[model samples]
Target chain A: MLDINKVKQRIESLKKLPAIGSKSVKEVLEENGFSRRDFLKWSGALAVSLGLPATFAPVVADAAEVSNRLPVVWLHLAECTGCSESLIRTDAPTIDDLIFNYISLEYHDTIMAAAGWQAEENFEEALKKFKGRYVLCVEGGVPTKDGGDFLTIGPDAETGLSKLKRTAKDAAAIIAVGTCSSFGGIQAAYPNPTGAKGIHKVLNKQVINVPGCPPSAKNIVGTIVYVILFGQLPAVDNFNRPKFAYGMRIHDLCERRGHFDAGEFVEEFGSEEAMNGFCLYKKGCKGPYTFNNCSRERFNQHTSWPVQAGHGCIGCSEPDFWDSMAPYEEPLANHKFESISADATADKVGITILTLAGVAVAAHAAISAIKPPKE
Target chain B: MKITKKIITKIEGEATLKLYKKDSLIEFAEIEFWQYRGMEEYLKNRNYMDACVINPRICGICGHSHLIATSKAIENALNIKITKKAKILREITLGLEIIQNHIKWFYITLYPSVKEINYFKALEFSREIAKIIALIAGQFPHNSYAVPGGVTCDLTNLEIIKVKNFLSKMFDKYQEIIDINGKSEDLEILFEDIPKETGKGINKFLVLGDNLYFKSNGNAEFIKEEDSISLNKNVLYKGSFYEVGPLARNLENYLIKKVYEKYQDSIYTRIFARLYEVNLIFQYLLKRIDEIDINEKNYIKPTKKSGKGVGIVEAPRGSLIHQIEIEDEKIKSYNIIVPTQFNLSNGTKESPSPAQASLIGEYEKQSDLIFKCFDICAVCVSH
Candidate 1:
């Protein structure tokens, strides 16, 4: 169904442009929907669509070899591996291809084949070999409770907290890839037992945090590209994430923002109001409080994100996505409210009114029956 | 020997794996999710819409899955039927997440665990793949695009083109990745001379199955309804206990035999499977883009209805189900069952936990084995 040659030829043409690669050229084409045939038939038109320099297609092959691929060491501590799950699903460059040609991933625990002493050996070897020149990506927060027994790496001399600290010390830069590593996420929420913390607190150094339940692939890749292209970190937010990615609020870009502003909400599910695509705010949409481009970058290769799926933003991008945002039905309340508290919709109003009316009638009848006897 | 193996450090939430071993082998194991947010209990008597907000907070990576599942649950409770557009939109969003999640795990999570593979490049590759998807959604790791009745965003022709282009880019990347294992005869011979780590032969793989055919118009029909996987859905494992997570989802799709037919049941097989998913989803996304008629109705408005509703979807982690009871515009009772519950729950006498049951007679290192069998997210578990 998709013409492969036309795509390849256009990619070849785009490769000729300055600062472009097979990867980037392909990205422009895919994002703009210029099939290979489209490229072959209308390179100029496709170029205009992607806002590309006209000379891109002629010389891309020469520029494709500048691989500033860095070695990355990913550390996990207190986490659910959801960040890991999120990381594996990048549709644009697809992780597998990246691993094959672009970057030199030296060591990690989950996807690697080496285990036990050998796995640990690989980590140590990579540390010594790639020290101060590798990228350190942390997915989970570190537990600082009781000498960090909350997490350990292999029933050995090294604890997870200590290993993260040790590994982070030698890295050129650290990418905190998830909310857990960014701000301790839920493990550190509400009386954190392990004293779980983000990389900034544990490492005693500044790290770029790509925060989210699992940060989008663009933020992660764009930041990496910025670093690769410029040999330095991109401009970042106060939270240490690149400003380019974490700049917008979910509500600002929401398609249903008009409905929210109009105060037209779905009062009940399966109701005509709900079927009509009303606002989910009263239904607990957190687009107002959350920050992310979910409305713009629908998940699954731009297919859709959570909100488009007929749900509301749950604010997974913020710190403490679990504890701070839970009782998911209630609005953001001040402290002192119990965690996981429900909202008022659970008690149907009709039942309460019916119960009250029935009780009143029964009371009156009993009273009348008793009055006759007394008289 | 009484061996106390304590596994901790968390991603979404905190959890500890305490294993009792005999002679350096696991005799028994207990995984305790350390954090309990009590969200389910707190959801009592709350506005049904609250789920959209709270459920996503259950776990960051799968928060989108929670948002969709929770919304479906509320819709079910209210006995509301969302529009075909809305349903397809939900599926697309989830599919995107699945693509992102699978790539993340394959490169960031699974590949890192392998001793022979280089993961820094993997991270780069993974991020690039993520970036393409992010361009459309604008960011990664997490995106909140769903609303109560439909998504808050709409795609333009240019944007649709952008998605198709991104998918094409992903295909090129996938081909390159496939080439790494020596797809080229010359390169294979050159690489073969150099000693490299290969997969230890293991014939164990688990998968969830989705074998329903979509109509030419792109609408899917259900073979049966069982919380998740309404259209000819089935869960299978070698030992009756299949795996769940990115690996399982990829395997399921692979079993459907639409994408990534090259690799199967090896270290590279597993890695390539996840990578292929990114490419495969691109095809699906392209088709979906065409199927979406902007002029078509986005949702179906529902009124107060007295009935129960159940919503189910295949989460990035696995099958997620949410059931609720609503009477007269209010929730009478609410129940949510996440994929982790089915995968991690202690099974009946006849069956062990899907993850645990698969661990029989396999005396690999506890940590490595557990990571392979399951993606344990305490945040999803406790929430």
Candidate 2:
């Protein structure tokens, strides 16, 4: 229950923050040949996703109109730049919503025109200019092993871990964008040769984790919008993720739940059963166990998600999903690759094994196929 | 001349260019990639199907390319037989990926670098194309809908209608972009004051992937990765460096023919080749989408699960190869030879990589624009 008065009061003061360069958000969008209507419609959709009433569109519109855009320093570490691609690919690029109108992005490695020493200067200058003001948005995990030489940054070649430390030391808020930065991601899975860890683990500050192999633009934007609107991190789950976006289980809101209840399942990919859009539980759909709004918000401008396209969810939004969520073809709890029977036992999915008979098999059948299950 | 090191940003991942200048002339260049996620290394000990999900993360812009490539690799490893309908559908989606990738590269990367203004509207339309992709495959950038057999999603005639409607709106948006940006086709519009015939790197081509328009040279049929394949960033085909991407597609477009006649294999020929390919693919897709018989099957599972095979695709950047050695459905070793490696391998006076050879004889400062022409993908090469 947020107080409307305090929200209004906070917005009034936050609106006075200094703008980047001479260009207002409106001017930048227009100069870029973008219509304000598209941005407005997008932000309004973001409000709806934020659980604010559809009527609250004007409230957001009012705040965004006057709110001085904060500088966002986006960093890439041991990553695929998928998160950057995910964030910058869309017009608005929300984590589905506000890289455009709400923030002044001073330095993003992928989108910025400059490179080499000039690019490195841009990063350093942004840190100096917006010291303690800009939000440090990291997109990958930090490698802290063997003196962290596995991943280095800039011409000076400082370890990625140190670069992050230097950058995060003076940030207003720190947001780890994707699963790599959120939970050490794929690199952290299986042997973890680079010794990568989530930014929250590496950093001393209270880092907000937005875990998804590549989280939807809406969820990414939704978290940033929460910070912009409330001037603080929204309520977080146990994983330090903003609850506004990660509160519900994908199973509860899944479009194919009825099939799961009816005991109908997709036995194989592209089968008549699959074409019928039966539940993917037997086919290893992680929807029943995973959390996030993929089914509702979708991806690439809310067009579709993995399950909707007839593939099983990989439980990507959860922590260490690369390790835990695999044997991606089978259910999370029970690695019964041999059966689609009625009395199948769930495997070792730790946090939320949606329908797999509830038990934590932290490191279960993920490493097994012809071999026996792990202890 | 002192060696000038330029850190090339604004790629799928970060990269650096080491320019060896002699008397103010760029004599040779070496591009370096710093991070390696060990993409192939991690895929080991995992199930054969997992590579589809993991490989796409290698590069967000070309995730679908990786997905299709990985699916094909696994299918090859397992000797899967897919229907004709699946092949067409894969082509359609892959074409969509190349189209959206070109638009983003043109608008987001190329436009901003050259014009110094952000044309943000068309990016929305590009996402609309990604929506079309998501309609068929579930997600863009990362969705493992393409399995060992065929694809996961089965489309109906009604869904095809939705895709068409979206395409119509996309056409209108592109019209808006061309209207605002004035469809500048000249090389100056892209490189901004850079002279003609500047980035004419080694005038050779390589297209390993089989596409309908581009005739494959039968290079891939006889060679296998296991017998002899470089395990590093640099790759060689029959002991020579070759360029890939649209430039290598060798499209027989009138404009491309004229451009090549004028500038040879310079940046103009290379860049125009991509734009021309996008136009060709877009037209082909419009016709092909209407021809999709919803009655046809989309997938067929493989018979065998233990073997070695390679999957190759002409990604937005260039030729992408996925090599696999699977034992009993579990990956024994996975090797991915991405395109940038071919274009950006170490170069010398006698023999040079495509992009590297392009840099020779150019001035030091012109290296950035010239390098961007290749669309270097750092993560893909490293992965």
Candidate 3:
């Protein structure tokens, strides 16, 4: 449903007037001791990550070269700045993250110089000048209660809700950068005091939801790069998430699948089974039901993800994961899934969901076979 | 009187400083954080282990601090006595997180306010340090790898060697940039414009929680919260203002002592204290990383899962406290008092908060510098 022509038109109309001493991605890479070959290799890897063919590496490289012409306005809302922090710390120093440096970042409070009236004026001017030519990246959720005064901005104390709406009005592409913006995150759980909700819930338009507590920087940066590369929105799922990244469940690709299928499980935190890197099914991994690329792409520069670090996948990338994925250390069998019950095993759930790996031995990995609840 | 309202950006979220100037000096400054997410309120009735995951969402930059605090609180509540190896891993991750945060604070947050130096180099190094974290704690900013019993990570010798390599590379970069040594000329270059003698908040300092690098088992019992004009809860020690951060932690260090004695509790001391603390922590972690016995158990199963407990941790900003009371296997109450609340309490004109007091006698631009000197987190303060 992404209109490629509209994105192309916006790219063509990027004639606004803000001079940010931008550098070309190639120049930046070379300046930072990376060679031209490194740039091409990184571009190729990025193309692979974006699910584009190896032949599209040149197209991706072309996107990086002209990425500086794009204006980005990153907004912080009723959530932590993890997504923004994650963006800045996105350091394989790869082609994926280099897109950030080259993009004309018009208004991001984290790295932008201006504050108060200068900041407010710069924000106002960019929206006016760039109009429909800027990419808007929002990091948190919107609080709709108390007429949206819970979060305010600048010297005039403008409401954060209004700032988001105003910026989103003319954005060439709107990206809900984190889970907070995409699915209301933790603040919308149980007794939601601030009445916090996802950006899409309040806005009239659709946004590309890149959901994660602090999503893998590669995924976050890759989404942005996808926009600049093809000049169109990436193919998305039912949740408006890019299919390349969020298409498969984390369980499908989890390295611990053999352990789960073999009926070996970590009974407790420091148990022998845990040290051996056994399946964390008994320890309550949400990886099976959780849809994400954390198992594949990993985090912090392809180093290690949650499961590799020895904890169960917390399912941070799923919608309303905070509420739905509660009693965190317990299995999801207790939840109100139609096919699942308290005594159900991964094998049963795997069978019910045709796509999930048939966990033939999940019944053997259950509570009775494993360590029972200790008082 | 000339009143000027300015929104302080580029820190962990933003703050509005309403300054009232009499002649040239600021007479009284009011700091307001309009952002509020009811962190403690939503935490109510959540499952006990759930708090360890949810509490860290309070602030992205210092989530490790919250994770440590929340994890420790659950440990204290449920009588979960983790192995020493587990403690070491937890402390290692926490230390690296501080280094990562300080790297950003120095380059991304504090540096640009002073100069236009390209800080991406520091960010690159910080990721090396963060990779070390991901190696241990899964991820940075919001990794809930630290559970109550212990951390989830079981380190390999390869990971240990990788951590050492990262630390070596990190220090190699650190040597190039930060050197607050009394003999070092870097301080003059970094804080060239600002009057180094300026910033003197409530001179008193405080530190809470058991620490890894520094020695502090300060109590959170004396802490109290009162209503303030700012959206942040006004935190006080026995109902009075006190400073709580790096300057509080390291007053006696050779690198910071000379400067501290020269400009007691000023921005120079505060900034140097943080910078020097980075130097000290990096050295400490280098040695501490060697002490990890991977053969030892990472955790111990708790006997009880219900009780009242408090967890205090010295986050990058300052002391972070998480108090929890679990009843019938659920969180009956959860309270979080972040470091920013201690630093920036918009108290009455006669008696402002520690960092607020620092802004009282400065010009507009310098006040922004001084306020950032405290390194307050608007997100944490409201949470």
lDDT of 3 by residue, B60-120 (tens): 8888899999988888888778887788888788988888887778777777777776776
lDDT, candidate 1, B155-230, per-residue tens? 5557657766766676566565543232433223323432222222233333232311121111112212232211
Q: Which stretches of candidate 2 lie over 4 Å from their true place?
A: A29-44, A53-56, A66-69, A89-104, A336-375, B165-188, B221-232
- List per-prediction Cα lDDT, in the order shown: 0.53, 0.74, 0.78
lDDT tens per residue, model 3, A1-375: 444455445445532334345555567777778777887887888878888777777666666666766778888898888887777667444555556855635788777766656777888888888788788989899988998888887777778788888889999899898899998887776566888889998789779999998887778778888887566688998778898889887877889888877878887987789889999876879887677888888878777888887778877877767766666787766544431122322333333333223332233444333232333
Error of 2 at B331 (Å): 1.1
Cα-based lDDT at residue A229, candidate 3: 59
Model 1 chain B TM at: 0.72
Q: Is candidate 1 or 3 superior in DockQ?
A: 3
- TM-score of chain A taken by itself, candidate 1: 0.71
Q: What tens-digit string does per-residue lDDT give for candidate 2 at A115-213?
A: 668788978898888788787789988987887877866777688899999999999899999999999988887657788889998788999988887
Q: Rank the candidates by DockQ, best first.
A: 3, 2, 1
TM-scores for every predicted model:
0.54, 0.91, 0.92
Return the lDDT, model 3, position B106. 77
- Residue-level lDDT tens digits of model 1 in A68-106: 235667776666565655555553334323321234334
Could you tell me the TM-score of candidate 2? Answer: 0.91
For model 1, the docking class works out as incorrect
